[model samples]
Every structure is written in structure tokens, then in C-alpha cells.
Target chain A: MTLPKTRWRRRSAARPDEILDAALTAFIEAGFDAARMDDIAARAGISKAGVYLYFGSKEALLRALIDREIAPIATLLAGFAETGGADPEGTLHLMATVAIERLSDPRFFAVPRLIIAISGRFPDIADYYRTEIVERAIAALSSLIAKGVAQGVFRPVDPVLAVRAVVGPVLFAALWRHVLRGDTDVPPARVIEGQIDLLLNGLKP
Target chain B: MTLPKTRWRRRSAARPDEILDAALTAFIEAGFDAARMDDIAARAGISKAGVYLYFGSKEALLRALIDREIAPIATLLAGFAETGGADPEGTLHLMATVAIERLSDPRFFAVPRLIIAISGRFPDIADYYRTEIVERAIAALSSLIAKGVAQGVFRPVDPVLAVRAVVGPVLFAALWRHVLRGDTDVPPARVIEGQIDLLLNGLKP
Candidate 1:
């Protein structure tokens, strides 16, 4: 009983993730509009029916892919926002480090790249992404910055704009590395450190 | 003689720009590979043969489009770097203001957004863009930063990383407003001011 139940649970839990991975590969290789359910199913080593059983449509698969990949990061940011009130500066440093590390990975960056590509054609997809992921992340970061301002550790700045400054560099680094395929002699960690330093200390002596 | 020469020059010079604008619209509507020369020619109110007479192929058209749109911005950055050594801080402020104002326009932002979309499949195009535009811009900005540091105006920092810090937020704002279609209640000018403030003045109270 124990062996059978353990095996069943593992297989059931992993199937959705496997399908999502296959969907992402298919979407990347073929644009979202052109990617076929059959290709995704073949990539997953499953039947098309099986793919449909898991995700009702291609759009659903994309939404799920975004959720699976981005939801954890959002959760982590929320956690920081909740508990890092005492040391907003330190927390921001940690957040930047973690974000750069994760966003540097091509796999993690792919969904956002895909979103950027198709957003012009599919406004709904863009809106969905903004509401589900970006707004949440920005809100969490803004709350943390607000906390810092409240505690008098940081200068009085609009948290909304501050969130953009904090996030813009990290997003740019990811775009530079992945989308542009630029050569990176400087390690991402160092890039993150440099950005955070400039962000916190500025260039003025 | 003067009328004929002036008319001829205007028709010839403006034809290329008109064709390039049509090409951009066609490319945006259809992904680069799928876009048709006929569509571009038709959009430009010319025959396909006319388009071929001017630009040989879709790839050539893309290259020309990039050059027509982006070369001026690169030139502007170089100009600033050359004459802006005396007042680096003021120049940076002016640069950011100009960059944000230009980049905020959807038409101006279109090329970079298009590049990001297709760069995965077209590494050569990406390379061409980086060498022709991004590298040149970064070099110019780095020289300005180095000049500032030499003048004892700015803190000692690696100019390359510093360039990233300076360019990243402006790029991000463009992406957010255009690619993501995020609603912007605050004017782009204010956003640029806030980012510049954060960069020049540390968050330390």
C-alpha cells in the first residue's frame, strides 16, 4: 500500500510540470500562435488527449507555465516584504541577488521573453501576465521600500518609482544576457552587486 | 534646373525612408520571417521590383530599417560624450531626459522591441545590432563616465557596469510602457527624474 500510494502521488504531481516544460519548448521553438498541441504532446511523450486533459487550451498552458515559473518568485518576494521590515536595505540586497541569479538562467527568462514577443498580438495575454505576476511583484517590492521609508532608514522617495529603479536594472541584465545574447565578462553576481551599490550609494563621492 | 534637381533629390531621399517605415509596419504586423516584401512594397505604394531595386532582401531591409531608425540615437550619444565632459552630471540628466522622451514614443520603441522578439532565431541580426548600436552607445557613455571620474565629480566605478546602471532603467521604462502595455499614470518625464534622483543620490537618509 505504501509503495503504490507513493508512486501514484509522485506521478500525478509531476505530470503537470512535465507537460508545462514541453509546452514551453514548443512555444519557444514555434511562436505561441503557431505552436500546436500535437507538438507539445509529442514533446511531452504523451497523447494530445492527455495534453488536453491537463490543460484545456494552449492559452491555459501558457498561463500555467507563467504561474509555475513566476509564482514562486512572487511568493518569495512577498515573504521578504512581510518579514524584512527591520532591514529593508539588507533585504533589497538579498532580493537583487536572488532575482539576478534566477533571471540569469535562460529557462527562467524564456517565459518573459515569450510574453514580450506575443504581447502585441495578444493583449489579453499581456494583461493576464501583468495582473498575475508583474503587479504582484511590484506591489511587494513597493511595500518593502515603503517600510524602509517608514523606518527612516532610506530617503523619502516614491515607492512606486523606487520599485522601478530597483527592478529596472535587474530586468535589463536579464534582457542583455538572454534576449540580446551579449557577451558577459562580468559575472551576474558582480553585476547585481554593482547595480545595488549604485542604486543604494549612488555615484556621487 | 533648380526645381528639377530639388524635386529629384526630395523624391529619391524620401523614398528610402517611406519604404523603411512601411517595412517596419509590415514587420511588426508579421514576424520577420513571415513578413512579405510585397506587403512592404504595397504599403509603401511601390512595386515589389521597386523595393528590390532599393533593398535586395528582407534581411537587408531589416538592416537598413535598424540603421535608419537607430543610427541617429547612437550619433546623439557620441555627440554628448564628446562635448559633455565638462559637466557630466548635467549631461547625464539631459541624456536621460532626451532618451526617455524619444524612447517613450511607440514608433521609436518598435525596433528594439522587434529585435528582442526575433533575436532568439536570428543571432546574426542580434550581433549586428550589438556591434553597430549597443556597443557604440556603451563605449560613448563609458567615456563620459570615465571623464567624470577623472574630473573628481563621480565616484570611482567601472565604467561598463556604470553604463548598465545608467541605461537599464531607461530601457526598462520603454519595455514597460510599450511592450507590456502597462498603463502609465505618471508622465515619463517624472519617471525619468525619479530614476535620475535615485541614481545620483543614494537611498541613505
Candidate 2:
């Protein structure tokens, strides 16, 4: 009974993740409107039926991909919270660094582009993006800003607005570099550092 | 002779402009892929062949739309340049104010959204957008930053990064208010002022 249970657990864990990985690549390249399930299965070296067994449909597959990728970002925010928000700059720096690092990882970068690429065709996906990813991120950063303000380390700024100020430029730059421009030579770390500095001192004040 | 000349001039100018306006609306709503020439012609209250007589094809119509709508943004930048780079903050403030004011004009708002929506499907359009709109804006902002740095008004920040820092938040907020969130209650001017203030002062700096 123990041997059978161990084998079942091991088999289920690896195959679904593999299918998701293939699905992400296919979705990014061909877009949701054009991507075929058969291609995803072929890329994953599995049957079309097998891919469906993991995710009931392509939409479900996208949801799963989003869920898998976003979990780590949530975890990172949680870890930042646990530190009592002692260093706002440090926390922000870490967030930027992690985001930049993860963007280089093929699985992570494909998710947002996949969302943007399909968003017009399926408006529901855009709503999912706002609720699942964008709102969560804003909430986490808002809390961090509130913590810093309470500690008297930060100014009395609207946390939501502050979070936007802190993260907006970095995210936009990353989007331009990685997705729009496809220029890999520009180091994300340098861009993050410059952005963080601008945020810290601001344009004038 | 005067009567015949006046009739021809009125026929050429008014009809084409009306057709362009209708095409802009239909393109914005339906996007390039889904927009039909017949629908545009019907919207313009002209024959389908008449629409072709002016623009030749759907692609040609889009090209004409881009020229009519986006050329003004370039003209605005050129006007700003002609004023001389005296005050960075003042110039930027003026630009923001004018941009927000122009949001009341549906053509100003809808045309860009149309381009963003359709650019992914048509690579040529995307290339034109990158080359014509985005690159020009970046160059203009970069020039402004360089001028500011030279005059000892702004810190000697990286011009590219500074432009991103200044523009990204404002653009995101505007897009959210107008396109995504549709919260027109909060005036665009107020949002622009807050963003400008944020840029001038760092969160921690």
C-alpha cells in the first residue's frame, strides 16, 4: 500500500507541471487565439488527451499557469511582511531583484505576455489578471508602505499611490525591455537600481 | 467657374474627413482584424466603393487614420521644442495639462487604444507604432531631461530612466482612469498634478 501511494504521488506531481511549462511556451509564441492544444501536447511530449487530463481546457490551462507563477510572488510578499517592514528600501530592492531574476526564467516571463496577448479576445482573462495578479500586488505593497509609514521611516503618502509610484516605473521599464523591445543586454538590476534611486529622492523633493 | 470650383472643394474636403472620422470609431470599437470595410462605409453613410475610392484598402485607411490622429501629438512636441527648454517642470506640466484636456476629445483617446489593440495582429502596424509614436516620444522626453540637467534644474540622472520615471506613472494612471477603470469622476488634471508631485519628491529621498 505504501509503495503504490508513493508511486502515484510522484507521477502526478511531475507530469502536470511539464504540461504547464509546454503550454506557457506555446501560448506565448502562437497566442491564445492561434495556439492549438495538440501543439502544447506535442511540445510536452504527451498526447492531446493527456494534456486535457491535466487541464480541462486551454482557459483552464492558462488559469493554472497564472496560479503556478503567482504563488511565488505571493510568497515573496509574505516573507517581506514577516520582516516587520524594517527597511522599505531593502524590501523594495528585494522585490525588484526577484522580479528581474524571475523574468529571465522562461516560465515566469511568458505568463504576463500570454495574458496581454489574449486579453482582448477573452475579456474575462483581463479581469482575472486584475483580480488575481495586479490587485494582489498592489495590496501587498500598500501594506508594506503602511507599515513603513507607521514606523516613521516613510512619509505620509497614500499607500496605494505610493505603491504605484514605487513599482510603476520599474514594471514599465521591464515590460519595454523584455517584452516589447526584446533587448536582453540591458541589465534589469541596473534599471531597478536607477528606478529605486529616483523613488527614494524623487524628481525634486 | 467659381460655383463649380466651390462645389468640388466642398465635396473633396468634407466627405473624406467624415469618412475618416467614421473609420476611426469603427476601428476603435471593432479593432483592425474584426472591422469590416462595409461597416465603415455604412457608418460614414457612403458607398463601400466610395470608401475605397478615397483610401484604397482597409490597411490604407488605417495608415490614413494614423496620420490624421497621431500627427498632432508630434506637432505638439515640436511646438514644445520651439518654445525653448527654459523650465523643465513648467514644460512637463503644460504637456500633462494639455494631454488631460485633450482626453475630452474621443479621437485623442480612442485612436491610441485602437493602435494598441490591433498592433499585435498586424506586425507592420506595431513596427510603425514603435518607430513613429513611441520612439519619437522617448526622444523628445530625453531631450527635455538633457536640457534640465544642463541648466542645473534637475539632477544629472540618466535621461532615459528619468523619462520613464516621470511618464510611466502618469500614463498608467491615465489609461486606468479612461480605458480600464472608466472612473471619469476624478479629473485627469488632479491625477496629473499628483503624479508630477510624486516625481519631484522621492518616496524616501
Candidate DockQ values, in order, are 0.53, 0.30
> Candidate 1 docking category?
medium
Error of 1 at B186 (Å): 2.2
Superposed Cα deviation of residue A51, candidate 2 (Å): 5.6
Q: Among all windows of ten consecutive residues in candidate 2 chain A, which has the lowest summed lDDT?
A: A1-10
Best of the candidates, TM-score: 1
User: Candidate 1 clashing pairs?
Assistant: none
Among the numbered candidates, top lDDT falls to 1
Is model 2 an incorrect, acceptable, medium or high docking prediction?
acceptable
Report the C-alpha lDDT of model 2 over B42-68, residue by residue, as the tens digit.
888777988877887787787777778
Misplaced by over 4 Å in model 1 are A1-15, A30-38, A47-53, B1-15, B30-38, B47-50
